[model samples]
Target: MELTFASYNIHKAVGLDGRRDPDRIMSVLREVDADIIALQEADRRFGARASVLPRALLDDTRWRPLPVAKRPRSLGWHGNALLVRRDIKCLHAEPLDLPTLEPRGAVLAELDLRGEHIRVLGAHLDLSGLRRRDQIKAILKQCTRRGKMPTVIMGDFNQWGRLTGAMQVFGMGWQQITPGASYPSARPIARFDRIIATPDWSYETSGVHHSATSAAASDHLPVWASLRTA
Candidate 1:
C-alpha cells in the first residue's frame, strides 16, 4: 500500500509575522494532499478565541479531526491533532502524556487503509533539553511497547540540527525523512520538525514537500513523505 504522511507545527495556525490565518494553513495542507496528517500545535480554543482551522475548513465527506484536548482558556486549546481522509478507517487514538513545563502530548492513531493497518504517532516536545530528554525516553518506551507495526512518528521535536536526541531517534528504527534546516520558515536554520518511519516501510527521498506556502503559513514548514509498504 502507498501512503502519504506529513508532520507540521502549525504554530497555532499562525504565520511567521504573527498573523493568525487558518485559511493559509488549510491551503497549505490542501496543497500537500497527504492521506494522513500528524499535526502539532493545532490550536482549537472554544471560548478564548476562534479556531483558525475550524471544522468547516475540511469537507465532511472526506476528512475527520481526532480529538486531543478540550478547549482551555489558559492554553487556548493548544494540542496535537490527527486529520485523516475519510477512506481511512480510524480504529483508535492513543494519547501519550509527556513531562514538560508547557503542556505536551502525543496522539497515536491506527488507520485501516485498503485493508492494511498503519500506526501514526504525532508529538510536540518541549524546548528545554532536560524536558526533551525525558520526553524522548517516554517516546522510546512507547515505541518498544507498540512492537513492530508499520509505524510513522512525526512532529515538532524541538531539537536543532546539532541536537543528539533527534539523532538518537534516527539511530533507533526510525528514519528521518526531512532534510536538515526546517524551522523558522522565513529563514530556516535548524531541523526542528521531522517524519520518521520503521524499516517495514520503504520511502524515497523524492517526494518531500517544503513549499513556499508552508513557509508562509507557519513558523515551521510542513514536511512530508510518500511511502510504500515494504
Candidate 2:
C-alpha cells in the first residue's frame, strides 16, 4: 500500500479571527486526507494571549502524542505529529533540537505500518538564512544517527527558493516535493513549506492547496504530496 503524508504550518491554528482554532484546523486537515501530518507552529501556551492546542482535539481517536521542547507556558507537542490510521503502530518518537533563538525542534518517530517499519522525521526550521543553515545541519546529523531507513521529513523549512542550505537537504538524498512557492496564503511567492522523503520513495503527485477554503485558514497554504514507498 502507498503511504500518504503532508506538512503544514498551522500558524498555531489561528484564523483571521486571531484566535487559536484547532477545530477549524482539524477540518482543514480532514480535507487533506493524509494519513500522517507534520505541523509547525503548534503552540501550547506561555501566558495571556498565548496560543494553545487542546489535547482533546484528537481525543476520539488513537492519535498518540510525542511532545518535544516546553517553555514555561508554551510547548510544541512532538514538534511534528504522527497521526496514523488504526493499522499503523508507533514504535518510538525522538526529538531533535535545531539551532534557533526560539523554541524549535524535530519529531522523529518509528512506526509499524502493514508489517513495514517506517522512519519519519518532522521539523520546522528557523526563518533566518543563517539559522536555517544550522538547523539543516542539525537535521542531517540526527538523520545520520537514526540509521538508514525509509525516512520522511516534512514541515515549514522557511526556505524562499534559494539553492543553499535548504538545497543541501535535497543533496542528502531526500526528494523535495513542493510547488517551490508557498507563503502569504493569499498570493504565495515563497517556498517556505515542504515535504521531503528518502530515495526509497518516489513522488507520485504534489501540489499547493490554494483554494478559497485554505486561503482564509492561515497565512500559509498547506503543501501536500503522495509518495510511492519502495
Candidate 3:
C-alpha cells in the first residue's frame, strides 16, 4: 500500500505576517492533501491550550483528528497531533511521555489503512540537543514496548544538521525519507521537519511541501513522503 504522509509545525497558526489565522493553516493543509499529517503547535502554548484551528474547520475537510485524551479545548497532546483521512481506520491513539526542559511530548497511533496496519508517531522534540537525544531514546523505547508494525514517524526535530547525533538513534530500524529543509518556510535552510519510515518500507518520493500559502502559513514548511510497505 502507498500513502502520502506529512509533518508540520504550525507555530500556533501565527504566520510570517504575525497573524493568527486558522483559515490560512487550512489552506496549507488542503494544498498538501496528505493521507496522514502530524502537526506541532496546534494549540496555544499557555492557558487552557485552546486550539488555534477550530474543530469545525477540521470537520469541514476530509480529515479527522486522532482521538487522544486531552483538555477539551486542547487540539493535541503537548501540542502534537495527528490527522488522518476520514476513510483511514484509527485502531488506537496515545500520548507519549518525553523528558523535556520545556513542555514537549509525542502522539502515536496504530492505524489500519485499508487493512495495512502501521504505527505512526508525531512529535515536537525539545530544543536542547541533549534532551532531544533522551527524548528519542524514550520514543524508541516506547516503540519497542508497543506491538511492532511498519512505522512512520515525522515531526519538527529542531536539529540543524543531517549528521546530528540525535538522528543516529533512528538508524536502528528507520530510513530517512524526506530530509529537505523545512524551517523558516520563506527561506528554509535547516531540515527541521522530517519523515522517516521503518526499514520495512520504502519511499517512492519525498520532499518539502512548499508554496506561497505554506510559506505564509507558518515558520516551518510541511515535509512529506510517498511511502509503500515492503
Candidate 4:
C-alpha cells in the first residue's frame, strides 16, 4: 500500500497579507491533496479557540477530520488537527498530553485502511528547545505504550538544525524524511516541519510543498511524503 502524508501549520488561516481567509487556506489544502494531513494552529489562540477553517469548507472535501475538539467551537486540541481521507476508517482518536509552558499537545489517530492498522500522530512543538525535548519524550513514551505498528509522527517540529540524537527515541528502525526548508515560506531557510515513519515503512518520495499559494497561505510551508508498505 502507498500512502501520501502531509504536515502543515496554517498560522490560524492568516495569510502573508495579514488577512484571515478560510477559503484561501482551503485552496492551499486542495493543493496539498494528501491521503492524510496533520495541521497545526488550526484554531484561534484566544477565546473559545474557534477554528480558523469553516466546517462547511472541510465537509466539501474528501477528507474527514478526527474529533479531538474539547470545545464546540474548537477544531482540535492545542490547535493540532488530524485529517484522514474519507475512505479511511478511524479506529480510535485521542489527544496526547505534553509538558509545555504554553498550551501545546498532539493528536493520535489509529486508522484502518483496508484492514491495515496504522497510527498517525500530529503535533506542534514549543519554540523553546528544552520544552520541545520534554514534549518529544512524552510523545515517545506514548508510542511505547501503544506497542508497535506502522506508525507515523509528523507536524511542525520547530527544529531547525539536524535531528541528531533526540530522534533516536524512535529507535534505529524508524526512518526520517527530512523535507527541504519549509519555514518562512517566502524564502524558506529552515526545515521546521517533518515526517517520520516506523521501520516497517519506506518513503518513496518526500519534499516540501512549495507554491505561490502555499507561500502566501502561511509562514510555514507544508511537508509531504509518499510511504510504501508491503
Choose the strongest candidate by TM-score: 3
Model 2 Cα lDDT, one tens digit per residue, 51-141: 3456676665445445433443333443445455655788777667778887667878888887888887778887677887788788878
The lDDT per prediction is 0.74, 0.71, 0.89, 0.89
- TM-score: which is higher, 1 or 4? 4
Score every model by TM-score. Answer: 0.86, 0.87, 0.97, 0.96
lDDT tens readout by residue for model 4, 9-55 = 99999989999988988888899899999999999989999999989
lDDT of 3 by residue, 22-110 (tens): 99999999999999999999999889988898999998998999976388898799899999999999998998889988899899899
Scored by lDDT, model 4 comes in at 0.89
Off by over 4 Å in 4: none
Task: Evaluate candidate 4 by giving its C-alpha RMSD to the native, one decimal.
Answer: 1.2
> What's model 4's TM-score?
0.96
TM-score of 2: 0.87
lDDT of 3: 0.89
